[model samples]
Target: MKWSEVCIHTTNEAIEPISNILHESGASGLVIEDPLDLVKQHDNKFGEIYELDSSEYPEEGVYIKAYLPMNSFLSETVEQIKLTINSLKLYDIDIGNNHVSLSEIDEEEWATAWKKYYKPVKISKRITITPTWEDYSPVSSDEIIIELDPGMAFGTGTHPTTVLSVQALEQYLNKDDLVIDVGSGSGVLSIASVLLGAQEVHAYDLDDVAVESTRVNANLNKLGNQIIAKQNNLLDQVNLKANIIVSNILAEIIVQFVGDAWDNLEQNGLFITSGIILNKKQLVKDKLEQQGFKIIQVNEMEEWISIVAKKVL
Candidate 1:
């Protein structure tokens, strides 16, 4: 099999919204590579291991995003994705109209390129996500561990958005709350929600890789039965409201989701969102306020912002 990918370089502020726009136009979820994330790969002396300890990681960078296709390839899908980008006036973003093609390699072979980079990261007071093949145990007196062999998904627990989402899930959820993770990348948030004490967690993402990753990580955490990973874009299949909703997605999706996010919340439900840049926090805040969600708090780390809001009745 063969595949095609269209990548664009955009400022961090434009990446997520453009990704969502591309996804809506037939491209699947995109790969986001913030400049610092790319740089960290080269700084072997202080690379990934340093990210585990907050003080070690670099603070800011631009973003690189690639829209991917699978099974069969379609030029029209690629064109539409590009058109959406152009039509929306997504700033500081550009890509060749030509799609990059690749011969499909067996999954195992394809993943080796990443092994040199994946490392065990302790994300919370009690939780750690360790990739398979790494030999680091949490030495902290009683740290809980979630081991994973992540392939092509979102939950490495390294991104501040992912970390903040996990932290917010821990802070807001209780033993009996029903939680939903809207963009359950790598299933990290869903797994964390269960580990944090939610009675159950339902997760959805448009990316099959992410859905598969969720399942893999769920088993890693030994909560296979408690976490349900499904393929639905942003609450499309949901029928019931949840006590907590966590979305660590781009700010524009946060804008588009604010309405549905408000509608799918149980009374007083908490909506925790990340993947927001420091420059555009007000755009999202304005949208949430328009949706009748009251901002409860803002968490910022190295220019990334996570906002916690309550759906106002």
Candidate 2:
């Protein structure tokens, strides 16, 4: 079988939204090549080694590559993807170069080539994300291991935004607490919440692909019973009071649902938001504050930011 490798030259800020666009268009097995990964020093406290090849990375902007089966509707699907991505500019998202190109490759090549880029990555104090194909063992008895099959999802669950969300969950989530994971891509945060002792989780995503991916991943970790994955827009009509609400979506989308988030969270419950660029930090912070949320912590990783807000009122 043949596969079309659709590569987009974009910015760090556009990663989440563009990836969503591709995933919604039926693209699978994404590969993100960022030059920043080469220069940035990763935290090796967990003794995980990161090996990156400079030749595969762009010298300037980030490169997002996804695999789509070459079929009769391939052209139409690609065009629709391009249109949807361009629409992101309406929301003030920086798309950077936005140069999209395509190449034909054999399925055999794509099946294994992208897997080399993913490894066992320790994102937080207790959470570690490893691909299903990799053999990894915990360095400590208390370590939390999350096995993800990237082929079935948009990411490997090690993106900075996801890392920050998982870290916040580690810090704020209580045992047996109910967690609401908005924009639950790959259901990584929801899985992490369960592994960290949450009794149950409600995972919601706007895209059906993401919803199914969440379910598949949840079951991959033997956590199917604890996570309820569904398709829903950001917190729309969600009335279940949660002990913790976490969203790792773009800041633009994050602000649109602040009121709903506040209404659904229990008093003194935590609202953890990531997928924010540096410039949009204040935008989300102000929106959360306007909704009566108290800003408790702000963390930065690379060009991304995560804000943890508490429902004080």
Candidate 3:
């Protein structure tokens, strides 16, 4: 089989949304090459270890590469991805140089390319996310392991936004509590929720691909029974109440569903929001407040921010 690698030269701020576009367009796997990873200091708190080759990263803006099967619809999918990424500008997202290019490669080459970019990374105090191919063992008795196949979704569970969400969950989630994961891309959060002690989780995503990816990842961690993956737009019409509702999506989309999230959460229920750029942090905070949520915690990782708000009347 052949694969076409679609590479988008975009800004760091546009990473989350463009990655979503690629995932929704049926990309098999993704590789993000950010120059910051080369220079940023990594905290090996949980014995996290990984190496990045400077040559793989771009000199300036970030590079997001997605692999799509070379099929009849490949061209159409890439074009549609471009259009959707361009649409992000309307949300006031700085897309930067949105130059897109494509290349053909053998299945073997494509597989090897993306696998190198993912490795075992301890994203939170209690959780370590590693690719399925990596042989990793927990460093501590309390450490949790989340095995993810990025080929099935958009993230490896090590992205800053995901890290923030997982850390927040670790701090606030109680044993036997119910969790609702909005925009459950790759289902990492839902899986993490269960591993961290949630009784059950409802994983929702608008894209069926994401829904299926969530299911696959849930099963990957032997959590098929604990997580219910479904296709739904944000929290629309979701009547199931949860002790915690977690969403790691763009700030704009997060604000749109603030009311729905409030409606679907129990009193004092926690609403954890991530995938927010620094500039839009206050926007989300204000919306959550307007909906009568009390801000409990505000956490920042690199250029992204996560807010933990409580539904208090």
Candidate 4:
């Protein structure tokens, strides 16, 4: 089979949203090339090693690449992706150069090309995200490792949004607590919640590919028995009350379900949300507050933000 590699030049602030656009447009397995990664200092406290190649990254804006099958609808799909990216301007997002290019490659070449961009990284104080193919050992007894094969899914569990979500989970989740992970892409957070001692996790994603990916990753982490993976819209008709409800999705989407999240949680239950750009921080905060949730903490990493709220009513 043949594949077309689609590359987009954009800024760091647009990474999360643009990646979502590409994923929704049927591109699988994203490879982000940010020049900052080359010079960024990574702490060695977690016993992780980095061997970055500066030559592969652009000196200015970042490059996001994804693989799409060479099919009859490829042209239409690419056009729609470009249109959606342009629409991001209304959201006050800086898209930078916005240059897009495409190239053809064989399936074998496309399969291995994305691996070079992924490696084991310590995303938070206790969570380390490693690709399924990497060999990594925990340096601390309390360290938690999540092994993920993103495949055609939208998450690698290493994005800043995902990192913030997992970090919030580490701080707020309690032993034997029931967790509902909305937009459970790759099932990373659900798996992390269980590893952090949650009694059981319910993982939901609207995308069938993401639902299957979560199930596969949960099984890979040996937590399949603890995580129930299913395809469901965000919090729609979800009546089961949980000890905690966590969502790492767009701030807009987050707000849409804030009331539902509050209603679906037991009193004093926690709501953890991320995938919010800095610009949307206060908007989400206000929405959560309007829904009777008290903001417990707000976490920022790079251009992303995560809000931890509790049901106090």
**Among all windows of ten consecutive residues in candidate 3, which has the lowest summed lDDT?**
41-50
Candidate lDDT scores, in order, read: 0.69, 0.90, 0.89, 0.87
The TM-score of candidate 3 is 0.96
Model 3: CA > 4 A from native = 43-49
User: lDDT by residue for model 2 over 1-313, one digit each (tens)?
Assistant: 9999999999988998998888888888898998877777776543233788899899999999999999999999999999999999999998999999999999999899988988998888888899898999999999889999888556676788887788889899999999999999889999999999999999999988889989999999999999999999989888988999999998999999999999998999999999999999999999999989999999988778999999996
Candidate 3 structure quality by residue, lDDT tens digits, 23-86: 7787877888898887777664432336888988889999998889989998888889989999
For lDDT, candidate 1 versus 4, the one ahead is: 4
266: Cα error in model 1, Å = 1.9
Per-residue lDDT of 158-220 in model 4, one digit per residue for the tens?
A: 677887888788888889999999999789999999999999999998888788888999999
Which residue ranges in model 2 land beyond 4 Å of their true spot?
A: 43-49
- Report how far residue 148 has shifted in candidate 1, in Å: 2.5
Worst 10 residues of 1 by lDDT: 42-51
Clashes of each: 0, 0, 0, 0
**Model 3 steric clash pairs:** none
- The root-mean-square deviation over C-alpha atoms between each candidate and the true structure, in angstroms, is 5.8, 1.4, 1.6, 2.0
Error of 4 at 247 (Å): 1.0
